[model samples]
Target: MSKRLRSILTPIIAVLLGIIVGTIIMLVSGYNPVDAYTALWNGAFGDVYYTGEVIRQVTPYILAGLAVAFAFRVGLFNIGVEGQFIVGWLAAVWVGVAFDLPKVIHLPLAIIAAMVAGGLWAFIPGLLKARFRVHEVIVTIMMNYTALHTVNYIIRTKLNQGSAKTGMIHESASLRSPWLQELTTHSTMHWGIMIAIACCFIMWFLLEKTTRGFELRAVGFNQDAAHYAGMSVNKNIILSMVISGAFAGIAGAMEGLGTFGYMAVQGGFTGVGFNGIAVALLGGNTALGVFFSALLFGSLKIGALSMPLEAGVPKELVDIIIALIVFFVASSYIIRVVLDRFSKKGVK
Candidate 1:
């Protein structure tokens, strides 16, 4: 099989296997898989409100997926997306609450602040990796804790005067749309989805059509060869991380401005950043793939909520299903071997 064909078939096969395994698990657990899956489908698409909600959830996932995928393109594992996301969220909300400008100015300003904050947060690990040969994984993992506590401190001591949440952002800065709400029976859908889709295009173009993108890919394929080709390995490394962080920051903005319109003292991590790793892996680290995988994730998440009410199946089953999907994707080598055997038999 061609590389492109293999890449396409791998995820499709993984998804099918995941569903099949989920069905077996449900059957063993004395549950009807058919009813459970039907309920899942309905919950994600039965009503206009549910459909709107899926889109809302998907908006951030796309950006977060892009963040992780972008780093992967340059051979970086940005485990700090969570830290960058949190800081970006905090900065966006800070700008939203602090400003009193027109929508044209205020909204863009808040979003830009989020990007800058996220980029800066990722910059530390990137710089360390480039300059001192530190492992980015370790630094970014440590930074996640640092961002969580520091944001909590800032929220309690500075932003809200001991409250767990910050004040609501001004109307001008909000991503909420009255028209969309009306259309979706008052779901929380907003303009953030548009931004998310635009970023998808931007990522595609940058990675596939730009000189910098070529250099980044070269560095990722083999850093030694990239260096011999006279590319600035260190510069590309830093730039890739910063851009990845910027995308993650936008994911946070989708929550702060579009979903909640404020920042809060997070009891723990949101899990979105960590999920991005799975998303990037499932999507084969491509922009188009990320978009589709994110939609699947959004559907599974929104649909799982209905499993309990409709079919008496636990929502946690969906988590297992997602995990299985990731496992299968990670084990693509085994699947490829199977495919090869089948292909040879067919030819014979």
Candidate 2:
């Protein structure tokens, strides 16, 4: 089979297998999978409000997915995206609360602050990786804890004046849209969806149509060969991490500026950055693929909220399904082999 076809089929088959496994689990637990899925589907799409909520959920997932996918393309495992995301959220909310400029300036400034903060946060790990041969994963993991505690400290001692959350941001920095709210029955949907879609195109164009992208991909494919070709492998590696972290920062901005008007202290991680890994994997690490995979994940997440109410099923079941889907996606080689054997049998 062609690589393109295989790429397309692999995710589709993985999703099916995941659903099948979920069905078995539901049956064993004495719940009807059909009812559970129906509730899930209805919750995600039954009302215009629900649809809007899905879009709101998808916006950040797309950017987060791009963050991971971009690093993957450059052969970097940037586990620091979670840290970058938190710093970005802090930076964006800080700017939003501190400034009172016009919407044109304030909104852009807040977003830029988020990107810069996230980029700088990731740069630490990238610089260490390139200059000191430190593993990015280890450095990034440490950075995540650092970012969490540091941001929480800043929020309580500085930004919030001992409060657990910051005050509401200025209207100028908000991404909320009255028209969109009216259209979606007052859902939390905002203009961030436009920004997310625009970023998708940006990622695609940068990765697929630019010279710098070629160098990054070359470095990813083979660092020694890229160095032999006189490419600045170290520079590309650092650049890729910065760009990837920038995407993650924008995702945090969506939450700060769009979903919530204020920032709150977190008891735990939001899981968005980690979910981005699954999204990137399911998307085959492509821009279009990430877009669709984010939508799927968003639907499942939003829809799962209704399972308990409508189907008497626990919401955690959705997590299991998602985990299975990721497992199947990660094991694509096995699926490919099975497909090859099945095709051979058909040809015979």
Candidate 3:
């Protein structure tokens, strides 16, 4: 097989192996695997409404995945995407609710605030790592908690304590498209999917076509070497983190402005940021890969929510399936061995 073909086939084979294993787990657990799968399919694609919701759910995942994938590409592990996502969501919501600008100005401005907030959140850790030699993983993890609590506090102390949600956003700031609802039957899916796709293209362009992306990758691969080659490692490191966070922020904004439309004091963290890790891995941390992986994740999530109602199965089983899939995907040696065995057996 060609190297390119192998690259593609490896992941597909791994995914199939994961599903087979998951079926065994279900059978052992005394659950009907076929029924569970049927429920999952119905939940995800049974009707237009469900399919739209699946797309909507994955929209944020795509953005978050892009954020993590971008950082990984540049040799940075930005665990802080969670915090950046929260800050971005809060910031975007704040802009949407607090401002009175025309839609032309208001919508873009609110989204931009999220990008800035998320970018700045990442900038701190990036700068610290570049200048003071701090471990970015630790700093980013801490920041994630900080962002969660900070947003919670703001929601209660400043944004609103009594109300679970902030004031409704201005019409101009809303991303809802009324016309599409007629087709989807008033589903939650909005324009965010389009934005996520756009980001994928943008990510590809920036990384493959831009000089700045080259510098960032260089710093990521070898900071000392990049420095010796006249690239400012500090600048690239900071830039990479900032851009990663910015993408995460836009993701948050998409969820907030495009879907939720207001900030509610979240009782706890939303799962988007953390899920980005899996998304990054499943996507292979590439722009196009992230896009397709996001769709898979989104569908799984949407389908999971319906299992309890449709098939008397625990919703959490989805997590088990996801874990298995990720494990198989990340462990290439295991999959390669399996593939070799299959090939020898002529299992085609």
Q: After superposition, how far is residue 175 of candidate 1 from its true place, in Å?
A: 0.7
Error of 3 at 96 (Å): 0.5
* lDDT, each prediction: 0.94, 0.94, 0.87
Instruction: Show the lowest summed lDDT stretch of 10 residues, model 2.
Output: 154-163
TM-score of each: 0.98, 0.98, 0.95
Total colliding residue pairs, candidate 1? 0
- Which candidate comes out best when scored by lDDT? 1
**How would you encode candidate 2's per-residue C-alpha lDDT over 1-348 as one tens digit per residue?**
677888899999999999999999999999999999999999999999999999999999999999999999999988877888989999999999998999999999999999999999989888998999899999998998899899888888887744699988999999998999999999999999999999999999998899998999999999999999999989998999999999999999999999998778877788888999999999999999999999999999999999999999999999999999999999999999988888788889
> What's the number of clashes in each of the models?
0, 0, 0
By lDDT, the better pick of 1 and 3 is 1
* TM-score preference between candidates 2 and 3, better one: 2
For residues 16-130, write the lDDT of model 1, one tens digit per residue. Answer: 9999999999999999999999999999999999999999999888999999999998999999989899999999999999999999999999999999999999999999999
How would the candidate models be sorted by lDDT, starting from the highest? 1, 2, 3
Least accurate 10 contiguous residues by lDDT in model 1: 156-165
The regions of model 1 sitting more than 4 angstroms off are: none
List the lowest-lDDT window of 10 residues for candidate 3.
Answer: 1-10
Candidate 2, residue 164: Cα displacement in angstroms equals 0.9
Comparing 1 with 2 on lDDT, the higher-scoring candidate is 1
